[model samples]
Target: MNNHFKTAMDQVKAEEALILRTSSYLKNVENKNVRRNHFLQKGNQIMKKYAVAAALAVALIGGGSGVYGYYKIPVNYLSVDVNPSIELGVSMSGDVVEVEGINEDGNTVLEGVDVIGTTVEEAVQTIVESATENNFIEEDGSSVVSITTETDSDSVSEELTNAAEEGVTQALENENVEAEVIKSKIALDRRDQARELGISPGKLNLIQKLQKLDSTVTVDQYKDAKVKEIMKAIKDKKKEVKADLKEEVKEEIDQTIEEGKTEIDQTIEEGKAEIKQNVEQKKSEIKQQVEQKKSEIKQKIEQKKAEVKEKVQQIKAKNKNNGTQTTVESTTESNSQ
Candidate 1:
């Protein structure tokens, strides 16, 4: 009888350990670090195996930084891709990143130049300032450099264009590069033409601009139009579209805002489905720490004395649609007088 009592004690110890482990596991389900679908699947299994009162309660709480991407409504870039190919991509914060080559001559001009951390204005100054200091060009105090800004921006209110032009012109004059500053803005029609043709807006813009001048020009008719004609057509189309950019910007923003709400809802549902499936697979695998708990769970299933606490966390995720935006660009001739 003493041996029988010892065996009973050992069984009770195992059962107690199981209860402790399962209880801890349930508590962990409430942990934010744990994925929510884990609770959902495990919650479903517990519900099916045990009474509703003792079973798990499931609240599928989900959310994320939805629609993760980037778009540029008014992407502005300044470049002088002459022999040296100098292009400066300016960010919303005015930070400059070199998007083009620093050829031998370009490097000579930008030597010791801290272009990385500098603002657009400061960066342009650095280039032109270095150019003048190195005597790359004769500074005769005459506006010899023409600063024209091209973009697909639809807002006259966009200070980036004129701001870039004025800023660059000033930088040139500060060091006496003696360059003529002529600011030209280009806005293309049917900005969606690029999407339809699977080409860059800038490329489609040039094609469409050519078509504007010669109604015969079309995407399929590219071979008929010489490269020279296409280039000239875009220049002519510039004046016409420049005045309409600001109006178009206002309209584009309104259009996107209205569509984003519906699109975001669909994306959330898709995200939830993916999360649930992944969680189910992960929960099916038993961990070493909870190794002995599974059998104990079945044993305790008949007993209603054990207590299980239900913790529910609700997640409300607001998704911001990271949609695509159009960008337009144009380059000048190699030697601009």
Candidate 2:
């Protein structure tokens, strides 16, 4: 009986040890399953985050690409061609230059003028006359004005000589004819002497000199022979002097004409260049303006996309937190049950 009781106690002890071992194994298996499930949940969360990031990146890249393309496209295209039918006429004389354009329509006339006269009075007079005839001058006479006058080489020379002769003759007639004849003859002889000395006579200077002569010569008769000699000398000298001066003036005018032609050509070329530059500048400015507008639009689109992405991230975070809290509450309720 004693041996049997000992054996029974040993058997009970073995059974209890087996039960403990089984329980430990089962607990280990359960822990391992929980660990695996946790790992899977974490992996799924990471994958979701990556997906969101990829979408945002794609959106941003697309927006940037779209903006680039928009700007790349040409916004303003300008085409320029010279119109052969459109005639631009330029007329120049002395310091006056006039430019006029004839368009397709007969009534259409575009004109511009620039004058640089030796004297301010001449410039102002020419501008006023041209403006008045062309109706460019306003009623108030305070408008931008330009005028041009053309005179041929030969015509200008003739006119100058005639003006000088008339001026000289008029001064001689103004003095007393009989009494001052002697002094006049002396003056004429002096003018001839000047010519022989290679001194060129100036009309204005001669007139001034004659006006300064003594008034006593106007009533004197004793100097008649001397006066006759002076008059004859003066007449002969004037004819020769006028002829030489005309030749010299003609040569100068011819040279001036050649220079004027060259200047006019240069002016036309410069005007065309300026027009081309302005057109190019306008085209570039328009293109830049369009590009700027496109850039603005692109930025706005990108900002909107970013805002949307931010909102989506916020919603995802809220859902994740709520799910975690609900799971924790369920676990607590199960333990309580």
Candidate 3:
């Protein structure tokens, strides 16, 4: 049993020694990330045997908690890129997988944050809250935040960027700090320029140079750009796009108004034609009625004239008969006398 214990002690010491040597070469968080990634990949292959060995060693040394702290980090990761650069990774279970950032005034804001969840916004908010709690940004100071994901898929990147903007805004409100926030689906290819004692992830393109971030750009123009340059480029591009949309909308409105005017003019012309046709038909009907009345009056006048002439002739004939009778009576009286 004593021999077995000695063997376990020797194995644990050997593992500890190997870890320390690798740690010495990790000059900064980025270097540490690369090396830690390598170890994770290697651990996967040898975990079955290593776990058995580690378990035996732990049993002999009675340090389970110490062993757990070394192995809880996961492979999923995210990186916050801004004037201050940070690489934040998470576990599959949404726990703190890995976090890499600066150690200075405004950049080291996320040192002791507890980031858990699948949302980019929440992570950003937590970072701001951490900063706020530490008074990283004063009430009069300004800051900017940008977010990127490990997934290179365009759709995912867009979603995460949108969430990040909201998250940063919330963080500012929570911390009572005001600042302009920009969202980028594309990751910054650079790191921070924080001066440190040893080797680091190298000088990243920090966005602190973008106090004047009002320039024009396209997605293609932004490849591998510094954070400040990307800011200016995106702003300029959006302005152009907005102007184009406004022109298009204006043209559409003008076209609709012209069409309505044309339709109304046609309707008025048709109405005028219809009114003229109705007036002409009415005039023709009135003329026909007048002609019929004139024909009836002429016929009636002719009939009345004929009747008057007949009545005059009848009276003259009657008078002639009465005169002959009177003359005969007078002659008879004379002869008798």
Tens digit per residue, CA lDDT, model 3, 1-337 = 3698889777765577788877876644585366435433433233334545655676567665635533444333355544445555543223355556633423566656656433456777787677667655446554445455543334444444565667778988877777655544333232222223211121122222222243332223433343444555546656766888899999999999999999999999999999999999999998999898988888888888888778888888998998899899999889899
Instruction: Give the Cα-based TM-score of candidate 1 against the true structure.
Output: 0.31
Model 2: residues with Cα > 4 Å off, grouped in runs = 1-237, 254-265, 268-272, 275-279, 282-286, 289-293, 313-337
Per-candidate Cα RMSD to the true structure, in Å, reads 52.7, 62.4, 14.7
lDDT of each: 0.48, 0.39, 0.55
Q: Which is superior by lDDT, 1 or 2?
A: 1
Give a tens-digit lDDT track for model 1, residues 154-241. Answer: 3421444555556667777676456544333344334344435643333344565567766766786652332334454566666556
RMSD of 3: 14.7
Number of the predicted model whose lDDT against the real structure is largest:
3
**TM-scores of all candidate predictions against the true structure:** 0.31, 0.22, 0.48
Best by TM-score: 3
What is the per-residue lDDT of model 2 for residues 46-108, given as tens digits with 9 covering 90 to 100? 333443555556558886554333222211111000110011111111111222222221112
Pairs with steric clashes in candidate 2: 182-227, 185-230, 185-231
Report the lDDT of model 2 for residue 157. Answer: 25
The backbone clash count of each candidate, in order, is: 11, 3, 4
Worst lDDT run of 10 residues, candidate 2, spans 76-85
